[model samples]
Target chain A: MPTRNDMLLLTGFVAVVLAAPFLFEPIGAGYPDLLQKFAIFGIFAIGFNILFGLTGYLSFGHAAFLGVGSYTAVWTFKLLSMNPLPAIVLATLFGGLFAALIGFISLRRTGIYFSILTLAFAQMSYNLAYSVLTPITNGETGLQLSQGDPRVLDIAFGRDYGAVLPSSDLFGLEMTGYPGFYFCGAMLIVCFYIALRIFRSPFGMMLRAVKSNQNRMNYTGLNTRPYALTAFIISGMYAGLAGGLLAVTDPLAGAERMQWTASGEVVLMTILGGSGTLLGPVIGAAVIKYFENIFSAFNKSMLGDIFSFLPESLQSGAVSVASLFVGEGWHLTLGAMFVLIVIFLPGGLMEGIRRIGALARRKKPGGGASASTPAE
Target chain B: MASILTVQNVNKRFGGLKALDNVNLEIEAGTVHAIIGPNGAGKSTLLNCFIGRLEPDTGTVIFDGVSLLGIKPHEINQVGVSRVFQTPEVFGNLTLRDNVMIPAFAKRDGSFRINAWKGVKRETDIEAKAMAMLENVGLARKADEIAGQLSRGDKRRLELAMCLVQEPKLLLLDEPTAGMARAETNTTIDLLKKIAETGITMVVIEHDMHVVFSLADRISVLAQGTVIAEDLPERIKGNPKVQEAYLGGAHL
Candidate 1:
């Protein structure tokens, strides 16, 4: 049962998410496709936080689960039906199973050694899916629905669905544009709720204990391994669900989605937002995805327009310099942001917010800074 | 008094060095038995063996009528033997209240409870029990403080609160007062004496003779990876073997 405070927080979260498309319109990410990506990746980051943020076990291979989920969801579409419900459920289950296997092996080691093990497992999966698993994954061309796909559910319903190619749907309601974004958005809310419950749960407390001191937890009569593995599997399921959504939105599953860089992207989102806090991962995911979409869209001509007031020579120089922070060179801006956050806000954006809030409170004597605000 | 812990002819070696050799000791169910030793005399090694951290090459360790050999460290703890480390191994990142609450949870819910969906704040009984444990350790005032921010003495007290919340059958202390000022040490001694009166069995390893004599009902002097003397505190003080081990001369 949620406390009164949790209920309020959830209400505010739902309100913001519901209004996100309108609110983000001026920022150029309000389109259905990009908004859906935001919701999908937000779920991904929230799941990653369960293990990495709360438990402090950095699995460098989470992309493997994501890839597995995408593959499973796409296969379900090809083999079963165009409905995303069955596909997503299968994807989550498969992702959890794969994570359980990997976690069983990887969690035996700690710190960097465990990270390396996860990385190796993910890389192995990527290599196999890219090459040897061509029969299942369809290799470099990627996996897509075939014209002769046996969508059993459609046939059972006496509907000849694959005249061309079928888009994912929820019981004949097509998953595209506003409807798709809303579907992903609703799923993100559910994922967020589960993460919130875990954060406040005793199991979450044990995971925090594992992060704080596993050795001490052991002597305190707790087995740390099962707790860690459970967190890993839960996070893996979240990644899987994200991948399923990706396939649902696009109807294509690519091996590239399971690569190390994809895993690293979620890590960036979590740490950049703040680990170990409830809203941090979702905020981080939004910030990263929003920047990825908006920053890459700006061209040199656009930059030149923004600096048109300056002299010709000076303006060109300014455009060239500023170009490194946008468009194809957007990674430079991301890297700079990461470095700044790590140095100034070690706890991520949450700490930065807290510091700013503290400053605001100091400026106003007898401000409404309650006792509940976490002490620095 | 009935024996709560019995170690018989246990031997352990790390590469070429004998970490513990032919070690045998029995701890009474309700007495504080102190083991004093110079550096490298295997006090830590012996304690590690008891907690299943190191498997002895020979002999047996029986605690509360069950063999502790080859079991996991957590299993040892579940069997009712808990240790307080030399550096105080409380969860530094958690609050002092949570540090106690975790051990309380382990004791009540056992080693692996999957209460993942239940809110921690709803566990009022556990919170009250943890608060009571903090009060016993004189840290109820600092319950909300981050444990890592606490002073060394308070951190040690928090560790004690964590251990005591489990209500272990045997409590092992490794240099519990290793790094402390005189005043802190005195306070620790008083706290420990209060704990001793509760009838919990304890095996304390210490280099501080002041702490040892003040709390130990009996003393065992370890030298060169073996027991050199075992007797009441008064007799152990007068034993020539202990005198030679510390001073290299009987008179000194």
Candidate 2:
């Protein structure tokens, strides 16, 4: 059954996220630095998928909330505690609240206009954070906990939560990066499962109906704007949680976290892997994160060393060609990947997998009236 | 018998054109009423006003003791008035079953929730209801077929099934048999007769006199955005006003 596939996917994801650090320990691949980024970014991209994917509304400024979440979390740390829990929670609440405001206005204009409006608001937020709200935003440097600030919970400001409770257990585990990773990973799994459930729910059907035909939905006696706004706010909260996790893992936040490019990065992740399909964004996140970690780590010199067995004359050219695959020009690869996915693989990897699955079951994609299948 | 839907002195002006001019009519419950008219007679405009798609410049549309003026289209729909537009509105992306399931789902549960997570395949009652509606409209076997791919008659049938699932107190149909073949039209007549036995009120507009003569218990002839004649089939068939309105005798 589809339910089994969903469970298998969820369990496989949790297992991978949890066991990654340990698995990578021997190969020096799963360092805390990289694993934490993947888990958090995965969260951001997945949340973005729920909004842009299901409703067919493409938001160009999602990073605004990510920035808002990080700023809120850092403020929570500065004024309240070094604890990540309250910071993530408060940040998520603000993300939802902020999205509700934006959704209220932006939802009035749909399609490309809605996208442009969200982008403009995000840019506006970025501008304000850089200048007008400098006192709280700390300008371009981003908000950070000051040494002079009194810590109500943790042992003084600069110290970790570990310093306050020497036993190192907040939720019955060592209150360290490991625990944060597990906590975030657990939340990601739960969010994914919830999104899957929502995708299959009647409400999800209405949303698809809205996407397919808004006029008909209205005639069917459903006010569609509120439904869309609800979806936007929920997805926004998920992005905020992802941002909070970033601040939690690193214990520092920056304005660049909310940059327009950061927002585009989530969009890229969702689309490159697949939008509107469960696990699509996760695959996308892994791909992008791999490029960030593994690909960027190589260069002409390192690549030369990687394939030093070639002739001395051919070595340098090979390294340069390989650089196009991994280094400064890796964007070309990403761009190519996106174009190919859009053209040949419109459904992303999910459709390909589905096709293979169908082939395995001795059925070609349905011809005639059954061209489209119910989305998972 | 009391009228289920009452339109009184309704006036709709569209910029430079008077689309509907002081139109007044009453649709009795359990009766199949037909509105026959020539091109631009405002039959479609009147239907739009009744379904709350277009606001009238004056007068009110009273349905089941409720005022339809200023009510949103969906709210009007919930009040038991469903409209089938001139063009078939069967959802292109959904199966015939899914198309029927939409109104059934909306009728059974109030609008907006997390129904996305539930498996619609398991909603036996919804499927049964959709199938039953489909069966009456002669589309039961095409339940799993995509609605957009249905033949003209089947698409109309699907639209009818969609409207029927809502269980409306009154149905407003604008040119329901507009593009159907003669064979399809008779099937439709039979279908409408079958639907009426369930005690639902229906207001149908037709250009085909055979269809009008076959199904309508009462008929109203519209000309230049106003009703020129209203009476039983026998009376309207011989009415001089109706004869003058469709003087070419082409509608027959």
Candidate 3:
């Protein structure tokens, strides 16, 4: 949150971000593209947090819904028009429907086994999309638009149904880069607000109840499986929406996007930012997307040039060591981040921030929060 | 008075041992009934059966007009029957208010929903009811304290608060003062007496003869799986059959 004060800070931060392309457009960081990816992934991570963070259900197959959504959105383009809005909605629906079916079966188990089931299903989806579902998914090369795209509505309107959108537009409305950026940004805000609402709701309390002491929830006459399943479905729907947005922004859908590795990336994002904390997943999404887009852009030659003034041997070694932190080897950094977070800070980075915040609060008089309070 | 609750032909076997054999009893409404037994007399088993926590191999547990076999514990509570477990199964992670709120929530919310948009404050009059229940059991000041941090005496009071919050017609307490200190035990006995005066029918399983004598309007003494005698406290205290089952065997 940036607070009200924090929100003002964040709003200012976003304003700076929106202006970055104009400020540093000469530099090819693609500030607009970077911001778009951040907002999109932020939505995805927030959805993941609801399922994994709040409910304590570790899902390893979330990528399937994301994939399902992407494929659905692309299919809409192939069958209807390349209108991004319709594709997004249709993709979200397809993702949620797919999730409902999987959640029904997987939520019967919990802990490692539950995670394994979701992972197995996700892998199965990946394999099928890459091969067996070739007719629909277009296989390894991935699904894309063709001239035969039967977007009847677009064709009836005397337009090419399968063509790529011209940056952005609406029916007689001008939409360019900033409008598109604000579109995704507002969606992210909506997603964050919804997650915050659920966190404070009685339904959210029941989910936590299901997480902490499931048996007690059962003994209290709640059929616990239904609650877990519902949460699973909702989270799956979220993944689907994120996937739809990805396809919308890029105008392509790929099997690799739905891989187990991608699923693992989401889990990493949620935990690194802190599970069970409201803004943590969004923060995590932004951090990971930034590193992926910006950090990886630095290559061995760039590193070599930066350290050219150093001795020749030390300069080359610096490139090697820095390369180990990014590019094809970036996962090592991601993995180490998770291990350190799990061992040293099991409550995640959010708890660390909270502790610091508490310390600052203690320096003020009468600022000690009551320990026994349960949030309503 | 016609019995409002009945446990008929109840039998439970754990491998080769018969924990309860053809146990039968009838409990009248508004009476404080006590089940006194030796260590292995299946007092807890009978209590568990009555509460639908453990199914008996053979039995009919009839509460009011409904069969108690397949009903959940909270559903049973909804039907005006509730049990306090032997070890006081309080929610350790919650406060005393939250602990009481749990059973009260069960009564109020129908156990589950997807009310993700509704605020907790507007859910019901839960906070006021939970506070009043705590006040009733003398735990009002400690309502905000974590239940796990409570003293044993306070824990017992907390458990009693949980059971009573639902306003059950039949309240079952299993050894409510089992491990309490002498002072705590007496306080529990006094509390039970005060509760009984309110006309809430109770069935208690107590090993403490002093507390049992102080509370029971009628006592059923069990030896082996079946009741050896059911009488007033004075008669059960002097019965030779009870003497043989307990006094002769050096059992409490």
Prediction-by-prediction clash tally: 0, 12, 5
lDDT per residue as tens, model 3, A1-376: 2136445645654665556456445545456667777777888888888888767899999989999988988787767766677877887788889988998889889999999999999999999988878988888778776665677767788875244443223453323355555667766776776776677666776777676666555555556777787778778877888888777666678999889999998998888889888778877887777667666667788778888999998988888888887777766777787789889878777888889998888777756665435455
Candidate 3, residue A165: how far the Cα is off, in Å? 7.4
Q: In terms of TM-score, how similar is model 1 to the real structure?
A: 0.97
Candidate 3 CAPRI level: acceptable
- Can you write out model 1's per-residue Cα lDDT over A1-376, one digit (the tens) per residue? 9899999989999998899889889877778988898899999999999999999999899999999999999999998888989999999999999999999999999999999999999999999998999999999999999889988887898867646888998987999999899999999999999998998988899999999999899999999999999999999999999999899998999899989999899999999999998888898999998888889989999999999999999999999999999999899999999999999899999888889899887778556566446576
Candidate 2's residue-wise lDDT over B29-144, tens digit each? 88999998998899888887777768899998898899988888778877777778677886777778788888888788766555655666567798899889888787877788
Compose the digit string of candidate 3's lDDT tens values, residues B38-134.
9999898888887777899988999888888877765676777766666667776567877787677766777666868765555558878989989
Off by over 4 Å in 1: A368-376, B14-19, B249-252
Please report the candidate that would top DockQ against the real structure.
1
Q: What is the DockQ of each candidate?
A: 0.85, 0.54, 0.43
Task: List candidate 3 stretches off by more than 4 Å.
Answer: A1-30, A156-178, A306-309, A365-376, B94-96, B141-156, B178-194, B208-211, B247-252
The candidate that wins on TM-score is 1
lDDT (0 to 1) per candidate: 0.92, 0.80, 0.79
Residue-level error in angstroms, candidate 1, position B251: 4.4
Give TM-scores of the second chain, every candidate: 0.96, 0.92, 0.92
Tens digits of lDDT, candidate 1, B103-190: 9999999899889788999999999999999999899988989998998899999999999988999999988887899999999999
- The segments of candidate 2 whose C-alpha lies over 4 angstroms from its true place after superposition are A1-5, A22-29, A154-177, A306-314, A363-376, B114-124, B138-145, B181-183, B248-252
